[model samples]
Target chain A: MTYYNIDFSLLDKTIKNFRIKPQKILLQFPDGLLGSPLQSVVNFLIERDIEPVLSADPSYGACDLPLNQAKMMGIDHIFHFGHSTFAFPPPSEFKGKISYFPVKVNIEFSWNKILEEIIILGWKTVGLLTTIQHVDKYKFENETINNSNITFVQHKEGQILGCNQDRATKIASSVDGFLVIAGGDFHASPIVVATNRPTLRYDPFNETFKLFDEQFRNKYLSKRYALIEKAKKATNWGVILSAKSGQFPKDKGSRILNMLKRKGLTAIPFIMHNVNLPHLSNFETIDAWIITLCPRLATDDYIRIKKPILTSRELAVVLGDLSWDQFITPKTGEHLLTIEEFE
Target chain B: MTYYNIDFSLLDKTIKNFRIKPQKILLQFPDGLLGSPLQSVVNFLIERDIEPVLSADPSYGACDLPLNQAKMMGIDHIFHFGHSTFAFPPPSEFKGKISYFPVKVNIEFSWNKILEEIIILGWKTVGLLTTIQHVDKYKFENETINNSNITFVQHKEGQILGCNQDRATKIASSVDGFLVIAGGDFHASPIVVATNRPTLRYDPFNETFKLFDEQFRNKYLSKRYALIEKAKKATNWGVILSAKSGQFPKDKGSRILNMLKRKGLTAIPFIMHNVNLPHLSNFETIDAWIITLCPRLATDDYIRIKKPILTSRELAVVLGDLSWDQFITPKTGEHLLTIEEFE
Candidate 1:
């Protein structure tokens, strides 16, 4: 058996030069990292006669809590993993060292589940959301909510990427909830909730934690229609809108255009420099029209229409390409839909 | 009084089109950045179309922290001021649309201050420390310490441009404190505190926060020595050495050779792979040696003699010719030190 058991003698000597006592060492980590790499690091240090300590973050998962932990533990050195957004203190004759490594990870979490859960919890109208990290993943989540009573909307919040909930709900006409799909709490769930729109969030990294599922979604929708009747007296019909990057088909503007054509209605995508609806002709007066969001204007412009409009991002489902629950259900809420009485 | 204003009616009109309701944007800031370009930005935004929300970090005093104020009034956006080391979570939409503005203030904050503070607490002897950020600043801080009672020793860990305190502390022996003069919390404080050293912090931006003055620093030091004393035990010195690249003297190798000449010591700085301390006769049983640190070594052989040594970055201080610190220290601790510290 010609075993490839080469030699670690040189490695041993080399490591000895870098050797440290079994002093406690701490490491900080960011979210979206796997557990395997951490284990490998631990093993690597132990092989060099060093002790390794680890700690995890609450939301971002495992931030450099381990690094702080190592310092507290009197560790001679620490190796941290995560986002590279802070400075690591240098060593002093009296203190140890802290190092950083921004390790990447796989496995993106879904947010459609979170929307389903909201619907189950008795929420009807919803504004779709995502962040820079998960913005690219919106397509996968959008596919799930293709055709359903649930209306999902996406908005392009350039500098206002997160926490444009007030704008979302106000423009959404009659928003019942917000299904946020993204990273940590920075994406702004409370802002939307503050506008009387309950919020359900699904972190792109952690999946086990969900909002709600389908069975619960339908039950809530049955009750939501009546609520909508009351809201319609004051507001109007609710719609699903998505306004992400064009490169990301998550907005599905072209698809929505196709859907409106099939519905015997003309859906026009207008990128206007000036706001003049006079040229719209019959577009100004229709059964129900959507501004096929192409970023010609902000959400404020859409509200002026004062009519029911489906979000380009969510029109795919209304077009009936996707199965009835394309949306993910993470938390339990009133934002679900029931197809029992759908036409 | 006459003020020159540069504005156009058309530009203002364009901005109004992008306007939503008033927004109170909050930001997290560090100390040194208190007087940085952030204030300029705040003024700029205020003059523009947006309302500004400000907050300072209490930990590093980077920025203002008006959480309660922002929450009570319901802020719309938050622009955080910090280093580029993180994808720092913006205030949640639940909170607001939080953004980031990297503050350019450099001062090795973490380990440097921790080491210095511990020494000032109760330390009789401590080896001064340095990292890439302010390795050159070691000289400035050392000059401030003067060779008086505090022994500002220099040491090196690796080729890393940033500071690594854990790696630094591993080599520090019998040190009561290791004063690091860097910026931010992660720079030196983490490493020093991990070794149980009572650390002291000196933020270049301290004045921006209206926090401490020089008098406070002086008072803090006397007390700091006591703190360091309670933190650890002390040890007698062993090797007192120096390197050719000690403290990056403008004269480089000449300085170390000169110092050795003055001491009548046959200490030959090995710029090459020769670390063999010629067991020559008659050298004072050294107290603690200096391991000169070279900026970008020609070869990795200088660190061959890992015995307690001072780095060239540190030696640049002992000899009092270090000029690069002006850039490094200011850049180390600022929330976002965008410009290179060592211009």
Candidate 2:
């Protein structure tokens, strides 16, 4: 990555010319010790400044730097941002002061939300994880794990969470399956299976925990379930699907109409307009309406569909749960499936 | 929040009197457009730059900004570093040229690694998600999601992923849950749940996906469930846990030892370094041993014990589909119990 930096190259060269003498130079460090942090030190010395030079580095947690190389480059003193990652040894010549930045962790993820969701997931056992950058914070999370049915297996030593495969494999053998959670590219699931253990990748990115199941979600839910529930309620189903000015469903209100007619329930599929269904439009007659949700007027208009309305995906979800061959037959066209005469 | 700016307040008096009557000027953006992109423009006019000005705004995605103020502020030309959220109407009088700089998306997470672990999760249904910062890459992932039983659902309107509660809730109801692969605080879990969906967050700090169940990981991924199938076979009957470090179990490590012990095996527990095996010198007599599993030393050191060693958490998975009460006697230690213990 070509970092757009405040170019200090010109200033460094000016000092390197040795034309000006320096006393106590105020050397600034824009970036930290990830790469080179000896610029200002070298600049100060070239200008005849004394050895007590000051600079800083960011050590968010633990930091690994080229200290010997920095010393060789004529560095003197240092101030650090973030927490201390290394123990600075005292030089043979105890010279200048070294400062430390307190390690303060921002509330990036709320545990309260996690705990609440855990209750919702009915998760009896939880997989706990974090980044290696925050090792101390990882330990702090242990207590929180104690309050929940959380299994706190930590992935340590590597820059990312799953670098150590053997470690996670051993962990997988212990839990029901592993809950793999982490920030950035450091989730712990890839490594958890190294031990031939089953794992659930708990993605903290969207605050949801789902077990790894290779089978499609078709079995867990269905569209007919909504229709079934609505039918049993003995109510009229009002399906308001989207057919905008330029875009229209290829089926053009055909598939859903056939299915409802076969099921012996009255259904309508069309665009939402003011003149269509006015006045005493009792929603009791409508059982379940499948709405082809569109981006153009979705949030603005679709929210008004009082009766249970299904989006295209939601309709698909219901179709998936039932045996596809039984309800809908595959057909060749812009549309893939046709409602089988509901038989 | 403490911006290390040049503290231009010191130069305000001098800058106020120095006015540049320019036909066009370039204004660079800092902190992206999450902040006001007009800061530089306002400052320039305040500094007395009294003619038509050209400014560059590196704003991106569907994020909209006030351009009328700019036009009123005497903007005759514009150069943007990144994509614009809205179509720019051509300047009425100046007929200035408007340009764009496409901000390329950077993949911090390795897709190969993400794919490998998902296969292990063995789930038939999965939800895909990303942060607003990475919405651009969602199209490329469409093919990847298609390869498996995955459903990619993003907040279609206004691609900003995190920090928007209404959108998150909308998304939560739309899909089962989401697999969020993200970088920085932008993809944190609580932020993900703002959508009211169950989310699995992948850390993007590293170039590859590292499972979070190892003791060596940097992030605290205690909510993840990962199993490790190692090269070595375990022969231990049971394991023990400890609080000598004053740290509670992170869910994954909470209960492997007891499960093995319940299946007619011996499970032992000890304080830190407090174990004194009777057959310390015996090679084959010792069965498998289990512990909290912070394997600081390598397998080379533990070869003398010569038995199948395991963790308390690992044994639980082997005894899957069993009663929790049969293994662990729920104690009243501050140890929390999450879905990990039950699920």
Candidate 3:
């Protein structure tokens, strides 16, 4: 019942202070955390006399908000769990309706292990990146490491989002390598390919520093290069676009379509709620698909796609951008970067 | 490549007279028609120097339009195939942007077979209902059947849409039975149960006249009654609402929520783009789900849905309007009918 370690006091105080009597409220949780524990959360809300409706839609990241659903059902409030705030501004009307409750995982491992790994790897200064879960802990824990030889450079936000890693990319130049202070390969693996810097994960739960170095990068680079080569020969490209508020890269699809046209390739853009393979199979004419949606989907979801499915950055190679080779890793979070800006 | 039997000249003439210079257009076809033949249609548009973007999303019925996508990509026109005009009015902005091109399936069967079947069944008067494809032909052909005792009642619109059979329902009282001159069971099967009248189909391609009598209606009634029985015992119900233009039953979700509340049952509304099992599984507290979507899905898609899922009509039985027994058929095109109006 106490699994999420959510601040019940904070939630209660916020609801009391907002003064909006919610007849119905929606609770959204990421796919990983939508389990038995959520029932307890539902009971917690019910005990307070608030009717809670769980959003069954896929919550990939903070960017994929249930704002449209909230507005549709006239839900007074939405508690989005397991993620932090997105960089972009929410709709004006959604100001007080959304409340983010990020799950913070306390690092149970020794902090000295990261420093020992960095010294052994011969990296002088390493960029420290973690997910929202351990961002605060990593910031506080960084001060305890007094090794002058192995400096840890921290970004302004001090964390990385799965779909967006602009914070780490911004401070990539100031560090020799990147050390992700979190569990799992979800956030760490993508940063390695995106920044094209030496990246290693300091898993607190496992208490191990796993390297996602040259070997891992080369495997992904080869796969991306293969897709690029295939796309270069493709005459017709299906540009996939999403209409979901957060995932709608507003003008990105049009820009990609125009870019393809300039290369003398025939391309058409398709707008979808969620891109499913069964629906995409209807496009027999499209030899390849360029996903102008979440950058992670191109790698994470489409590894087995029969036809060559490339992300926006991967399409840059076909667009005659030779320097994009540095960021050849799939599912790399560079949604904002254009073909010309890939370094 | 000359498939689809589309009137190319008619299409050409319509485009010329519309006076809109469309550089890019969208082409949407039913899932069944999205095959090799569509390539010829694409070539037909491309030959006319009109760029065509094929919509790959699943087209359930005429109601599910890609308006959001059409607007997002700035598509000049949308050529929807295999369907005719919707019963409900389109949005004001879509007045000139959309066009319907229904696919006419030529009747290879003799017209006498229908009359022979009606005479054999001893029906004196029958209501005639054809799909958009055969509307014009049926209107002309109805004049040929001259029987003093057997009368053919024609509706004002002369056809019925798959998602709506209100036109036929309006004139059901004057006829002994309804004859749907459509190819498939999509339209005819639902009308049989909705009107609680004898319904028969004279399929054009198959050259057959089949009746969906009490036996067929009874089977559907049993299934729907079971769902209603299950929903009656459900303490927590998840009422799903959709925001997709056509799918969004504007205020129907809230109305249903309020109705459920009035019955002293605890229910919450969940607005979604489309209901999927993975998303619906997150709602552990909800024992049953009420789908306020295309009425067809509660019967067609949710057969395998683990938790008992009930349509609005089915939910009505649980809500105390016991007359839902009259409209026990699944996929009935009765969006406007409340439980009380069934009788």
Candidate 4:
């Protein structure tokens, strides 16, 4: 029943602890956990006479909670698995009904291989960063490496969100480099860019290590720079915004819209739940597009999109407000409205 | 500038007649009109110093308006082209700012070919049905056919919605068959099933005719029947509901949810803006799915969907409250809650 080493004991205990028995409960999971033994979870609830519903939508992170949709169906309790709670507060309408279950993947850590890579790179000190799923393994690896000369700077949770890399930023100054204990470079890229430090991603599932060094960062930034140059010529820009729980950029969309208009450029704001290429392609008038939701869409999904698309941060660079270096390695307090000051 | 023969002089007049000029306007179009000279529309607006934003989302009908999203961006006025006003009223928050411009497509009607087909079918009287785009052409075609004994039953406005076939049902008793002047069988299928009449679709765009007779209906019904049989084995059903302007099923979703529970079946309500197979595939616990939004997703897009999916009407048949015949050829007042009567 415990496929992918996801412990549902905590989930079962939490449900039992609820003051009132929920007639219906919504079960949400990230794409990775979708193929897990979900029927087991459903069967567990059904045994207790609780009706369980699965949220089939693509859940990106802890930020993408289907609470609003759950509320509409009168289902109060939602078990969002695979990620921890996000930094942002849920909208007032959807408060306190969500339970975040960071389902842990029990994988054997390739500590020797990681240590060998660190020694080969000649790193004296390293910062240990990981996602919620591998946090326990991260702590164990840190303790095991205590005998070595290489110092491991550990943050409170050792977690890094695709959007928020504050944890890595906090410990960046103290560590020589970062060793991200996660599946892919997706979690490590932000750390490398934001901290401007060498980061290595260790995939315990495959026991492989990929380094995100200066060369990798330069290559990534060059692609982004080319996109900014392409976006610079755009006079009529479509600002894509999402209304999702985590992805929604409150007043940032309007501020961007107002800034563009003041610069004598035409800007139209498009709002949707999930922004895809096919939907954005419908706007033929839009010379370029700026995505306000999920920065990855601007960075990672740029190639697939036909039109020149830039991130809100990249827009600042195009508007001549932020330098290319400043845009890539964003400092504290720098945001989408930094362009407004240039106005 | 007038690709697809869509006249925009009326759209121009409508904009000029506005009491105040809208600084930013949202242009929404159905899929057919998305590729048609949109830049001309954009240039025309730009010439008037108006900022035009094209809605890139797939607009199924006038009902799929992005007004809420428009209002969120402080865009008050929206020019929804290519379809007439839907039967349902806009949400209370978005009551007034919409201007529905049913852009007419001027196409040379193959009257001789249509007459020959009708004569071959041996139809003495036929009900005329056309969408708003071809309503003007429909009027001319009706007048020309008046010389023959094959009387054409004309309604107030020869328009048909995929969801609502009340117009076709209105003249069903008077006419022997229906001549739908449109492109595909998508618009014609509903009329054929609902009215139990032979419906012929004349694609003015291609000048081709396709007749949806008893054989066609039987073929369509058999597929649905097979799905119903497959769905009958499913204990956990995921009921898909959309929150799009026109497609939102409102209270019908909840009604179906309650009906499913009353019959001792586990039903999960999935509320999404755009429901697709990939997103729905994530729910491994869902044995089958019921689409409460667009009925076409169940009827037409069934093959694309992997699991057994049913419409709200079909759900009644699976529960044994409504017969398969009653489910397909639904009479007045037969609805999603018709199953509740048996409960």
True contacts kept of each: 0.00, 0.00, 0.50, 0.37
Instruction: Report lDDT (CA) for all predictions.
Output: 0.37, 0.37, 0.71, 0.74
Which scores better on DockQ, 2 or 4? 4
* Candidate 3 residue-wise lDDT, A268-306, digit = tens: 777777778656766677789988766666777665567
Reference-based lDDT, residue A242, model 2: 25
* lDDT score for candidate 1 against the true structure: 0.37
Name the lDDT of candidate 2. 0.37
On lDDT, who's better, 1 or 4?
Answer: 4
What does candidate 4's lDDT look like per residue over B81-100, in tens digits? Answer: 88887667545455437888
- The local lDDT score (0 to 100) that residue B284 gets in candidate 2 is 29
Looking at model 4 chain B, which ten-residue stretch has the lowest summed lDDT?
Answer: B334-343
RMSD of 4: 4.4
- Candidate 4 local lDDT, A97-204, one digit each (tens): 788777777677877788889999899989988888878766544555776777787778687777667777777777889999888778887677767789988988
- Please name the candidate that would achieve the greatest lDDT relative to the true structure: 4
Can you give the DockQ of every candidate in the order shown?
0.02, 0.01, 0.34, 0.36
Per-candidate RMSD vs. true structure? 23.0, 32.7, 5.7, 4.4
Reference-based TM-score of each model: 0.24, 0.22, 0.77, 0.85
Error of 4 at A233 (Å): 1.8
